[model samples]
Structures are given as C-alpha cells and as structure tokens.
Target chain A: MSVKLEFNDETLLCKLNGEIDHHTTLPIRLDIDERIESCRPQTVVLDFSNVTFMDSSGIGLVMGRYKVLNELGGTLEVTGLSDNSYKVMRLAGLDRIANIKKGGSKNGNQ
Target chain B: MVINEFKMTVDSRSVNESFTRATVSAFASQLDPTVEEINDIKTAVSEAVTNCIVHGYKNSVGRIYIGVKIHNDGMVIITIRDRGCGIADIKKAREPLFTTLGGDRAGLGFSVMESFMDKISVRSTINKGTTITLYKKISGRAK
Candidate 1:
C-alpha cells in the first residue's frame, strides 16, 4: 500500500507501511505531495515502522520529497526505520541531508 | 488472471534490460501487488539478468533463459538460467560490499533481491550454469 499521511500543526507524519518498490511509490508520491502542499507543516516525519522492503525507487521517492520540502523552507525527518532500510538510506548519503533518528526499535518485534 | 506462465530465451544483451523489466512488471501486476511489490520484482529481475550478462557470461556471447510461474495466491516465481562461468563463491557474492569486478556496483543486488522477495536461492556449477530463483508473495487484490 502507499504510505499513510497524518498531519499536525508542526509535523506531517507519514506512517509508511509495506514494501517500497517501483509499483508502490507513485501513490505515495502523489499522496505525500498533496498532503504536504495542503498542510505546509514545518517538519515532515517519515515513519518506516511497517516497511519491510526497499530499493532504488524508495531512494528516489525520499529524495524527491526532501527536495520539495526544502524548496518550501520546510524540514524533513525520518524515524522508525528498519535496519536494512536504514542502510539503504545511508548508502544514498541521505543521512547528511535529513534528520534520521537512530534509536527506533528493531523490526518484527514491534 | 488464469496464472499466466511464460518462458523466454534471449541472447546475452544489455539493451533488453528495460524490456525484461516491463514484461515482468506487467505480469506481476496481475497479482494486484502493490506498486512496491511490482517495483521490487522488476528491480530484482533486472539485477538478476544484469548479473547473468555480466558475471555469468563474462560480458561475452551467451544465452539467458528465463521462466516465470504465477500462482493463484498472487505469488510469482522467476528463474534465471545461464550457461556461463558459474559463481566461484556464492557466499562471497552475497556479501553487501564485496564485488569481484568492482566499479559502480554497490554489491547490493543480492541484498535487494533478498529484501524484496519472500525467498531466493542460487545454484551454480563451475563452468556449467547458474540459476537464480526468486519468489514473491503478492496480494490478491486485482490491480
């Protein structure tokens, strides 16, 4: 499924669920963009607690969102990433660009 | 979807990369697999075919055979078979950062496949052939 979006005054939280492959990203791209545009929150947090898989498409999705939010003078943060997903983000050098919180619990248990 | 089954054999070539991905993605769509599952299967197949062309055939002339089977439950099993120089060390090839012929390769193909698919297995023989099988459990929702 595409990632779910919930927004507060300062934060737009994306509850990412399921695999992040090529087929699934388009919906997310549209959903998140529309939500962010309407809410225009100061901080966007991507919660990957339920994501089980990812690939290059996932990287592209994240990068595209970051660019969009950055242009609007907004900030982006990623939390609750599984270890494997975290590694993929690191490989793409996203750690330097976004705020990635590292203390999230491991996968499968939660 | 009637569980479409397909078999194809093509010469070792790079230009067919996009075509292969498209075909597989289209077939996978029957499962009503989420966009993520579709993309994962495409990426994994692309990587496997690329590996066959590069490492299996050593960038030389050879043939790669692909077989796809779809189940009613929306699971897909793809097997890539190639008769080329087989993997000397399957374990080493699976390492995240290890590459026998290094360049732009992040050595993440196996990892990506493993992460995307529900199961994967590689069988090879020295100077014989290599076969990589991938299984993806897809959702029943019709796309």
Candidate 2:
C-alpha cells in the first residue's frame, strides 16, 4: 500500500493506492493520523482513485480518521470512490460522517 | 451440473487476506459474474479471512480453509473454516458495529457478508474451530 500526502494552509489531501485491507490498515491509519494531528488542518481529503480493493477494514480506516478530524475541529472529505468502494462505504454508513464526492480527485474538482 | 469446485488452504495472516479474496474471485470467474458480483464476493472473502487472522488466531499463525463450488444454475457456495478460538456467541458477533477490537474495526464483516451474499450460516465450537458458509446467485453473464 502507498499513501501520498499533500498539504495546503488548511486542507490536507491524502492519496491512497493499492489494496486496503486488515494488514495494511494499521500503517495507513497511523500515517494519516500522524499527519492530521501535526498539521491540524481545517479539512482532510481522502482520495481513493487508485484504491483497487477495500473491505470492512476500509470502513474502520475512514471512521478512525473521521474521529480524529472531528476532535480537531476539522472536516473530512472522501473522493474518487469507485462503484464498489462507494457501495462498501455506504453499507458501513461512512457517507454519514464524511462528505463523499464522487468522480473527483483529491482537490475535489473533476 | 456443477461448473467447478475447488478448495484452498492459506496461512491465517493479514497479508493472506487479499490472496484469499483474489483466489475466490478468480475461481468464481467461470460463472462470468458481474463486476458488482465479483466485488461482493471479494469483499465477503476478505472479511472471512480477516476474521480468521484477527479474531480467530489473534495474530498467531494458523490455517484457514476455503472451499468454492459453482453450479450450472449460476450459484456459488463459499466455505471458510479456521481451527482457532471459536466465537462464543454467533448472534452477537453478527450484529452490526459490535467488535471485540475497539479501534480500527467497524464490526461490519458479517454484516457485509450477509448483505452481499444470498445466504450465510455460521457454525462454531469452542476450542475447535469456526466455519462460515456463503451462498450467492450470479446474474447477468459478461460477454
């Protein structure tokens, strides 16, 4: 799994690639959490454009990040979800916590 | 008539979860399942294998057995078994958002499996093992 992070003044954009499963979730979680905590951005965007596969573990990843941003008074946005990814996230009720922008990149502009 | 049937065994490790899913999806390809169907199966397989690695073996190396059978009627049956710590309460375990691991687990494994597959059943015995069977009907063949 690969995670690329970009930061502006108030928004942190995370681009995730490869498969996100139980084995990879912890490292990805820690990596993103550390950045979010340090940067303390007003908004965090998770880009899933290159995420080929995700399971329930993806739900935990998003939920964990959501909690982190919420505590920091930061918002979380999800983008670039494939149809399958969107279905899994929706089933886990992640769309309720994070703003889901379909077909967009990390910048939230398609 | 049955189109194909196969069984595989893999180490109960987090790294093997993706392998298990990929194997199942490839095995089910004879049925020409739709992209949605393939995703559903892959997701369900991931959950089962992850359960074996996390909850069953608790990070210890163990063995996970998977069996896949596809029928001419366009139905697939998947069986995942692990000989590790068995679930005491299957009912509570199937409940959505109920996880033994507090963090990084949404407790949606079984829930997602139930939602994706047409039918699912779980059988477990303490100190013995657990077996989860999933059944789904594939619709709309790919040309």
Candidate 3:
C-alpha cells in the first residue's frame, strides 16, 4: 500500500492506494502515525478511492489511527471508500468510531 | 456433488494473504458469484490466512495449507490449517475484539469470517496447530 499525505489547514488528508492487508498495515500505520505526530492535525481524513481491497487489518489500521488522533483531541474521517471497502468498514463497526462519507474530495473537505 | 477441488501450501507471511484470496476467488469464479459474494469470499479467506500468519506462526515463518472445494450446488468450502502454537482457548479466540497480540490487531478476523461465510468451524490443539473451515453458498448468477 501507498499513502500520500496532504495538509489542509489542520486536516491531514491521507490518500491510500492499493490493498490494505496484513502485509501492508505495519508500514502504513508507521508512516501515518509519524506524520500525525509531527503535524498534529485536528482531523485525519483517509481517502480510500484507490484502495481496491481491504481485510480486517484495515479495520485495525483505522481503529489504531482513531485512538492516536483521539488521544490528541482530534478525530478521523473516511471518504471515497469503494463498495467492498465500505462494507468491510461497516461490518467491522468502524463507522461508529469514525465519520464515514460516501465520497468527497481528496482532502476530505467536501 | 463436488465440481472441483484445489489445495495449496504457502508460507505464513503477510504478503501471501493476497495470494490466498486470489487463488480462492479464481476457483470460485466458475460458479459466477456476484461482486459482493466474491468480496465476501475474499474477505473470509484473508481473515483465515491472516490468523495463520499472525496468531498461528506468530511471525516465525511457518507453512499454511489452504484447500478449496467447489460443490455442484454452488457452494464453496475453504479450509486453512497451520502447524504452529495452537490456541489454548478456542472460545475466547473467536470473540470479537479479543486479541492476544494487543496492538494493531482488532481481533475481528473470526467475526469477519463468520459474517461473510455461511458456516464456520474451528479446531485447534495447543502446541499442535489450528484448522479453520468456512462454507459459503453462492447465488450462481453467472450467465
């Protein structure tokens, strides 16, 4: 998986591409956390437009990030999730912890 | 009635999760499952394989055996087995949000598999290994 970060004021837009599974979660989590700690964004928006596949590992990635941002008094949002990806998120009950939008800008502002 | 059967043994590595999913999905393609059904199978297979890699081998690099059986009635059966440190408490392991790793793992692997598949059974022996069997009935919408 590859993650591109965009800073929008206090929101850190994370555009994720490829598959998010066990093989990719570790590096993805480290990279995202590193940026979150350095930037301290008020909101972290994960863009899943390009993510073709995700498993339970993706749920852990999102939940782990939620905890990190929550501890900082911030929040996380997910947008542009494909049908399958969104279903996985919902099945894992991630929508309860993070704001889920059907589609939005890469920056997650829309 | 069995239509086809496929089996493979792969290293218990995170990268092989995708391979496991792909291989199962390809075999299920003959039944012409819908996109949602295909996704469900992929997700279920991923959870099983991930369990073998994470909890079974504990990153020690072992081998996981995967078996797929396709039924004439559009049913698919998948079995994943790993010869690693087996689960001491099978009941607790299947619980959602229960994880021994206690880090990035959500412990939702079994739950996801249960939700996606029609039936699931888990058998394990401490210091022996674990075997997970999943069954799904496809709608067979292929034209």
TM-score of chain A of each: 0.90, 0.93, 0.92
lDDT per residue, candidate 1, B5-85, as tens digits? 988888877656556767877877866777667767877887688788778888597999989998776778999999999
Per-prediction count of colliding residue pairs?
Answer: 5, 0, 0
Q: Candidate 1 falls in which docking quality class?
A: incorrect
Ranking by TM-score: 2, 3, 1
TM-score of 3: 0.95
Question: Which scores higher on TM-score, 1 or 3?
Answer: 3
Scoring the B chain of model 1 against the true B chain gives a TM-score of 0.92
Q: How does model 1 do on interface RMSD, in angstroms?
A: 6.9
Interface RMSD of 3: 0.9
For residues A21-105, could you state the per-residue lDDT of candidate 2 as single tens digits?
Answer: 9988888888899998789999999999889998998899999999888888999999998888898899988888999866778
What does candidate 2's lDDT look like per residue over B47-82, in tens digits? 988998898889589999999998888889999999
Q: Is candidate 1 or candidate 2 better by DockQ?
A: 2
TM-score of each: 0.59, 0.96, 0.95
Off by over 4 Å in 1: A1-110, B141-143
lDDT score, candidate 2: 0.90
Ranking by DockQ: 2, 3, 1
Is 2 or 3 the stronger prediction by DockQ? 2
Report the Cα lDDT for residue A109, model 2: 50
Best DockQ among the predictions, by candidate number: 2
For A13-95, candidate 1 gives per-residue lDDT tens digits of 88888766544666788899899899998988888878866555566677778888988889888888766577667766778
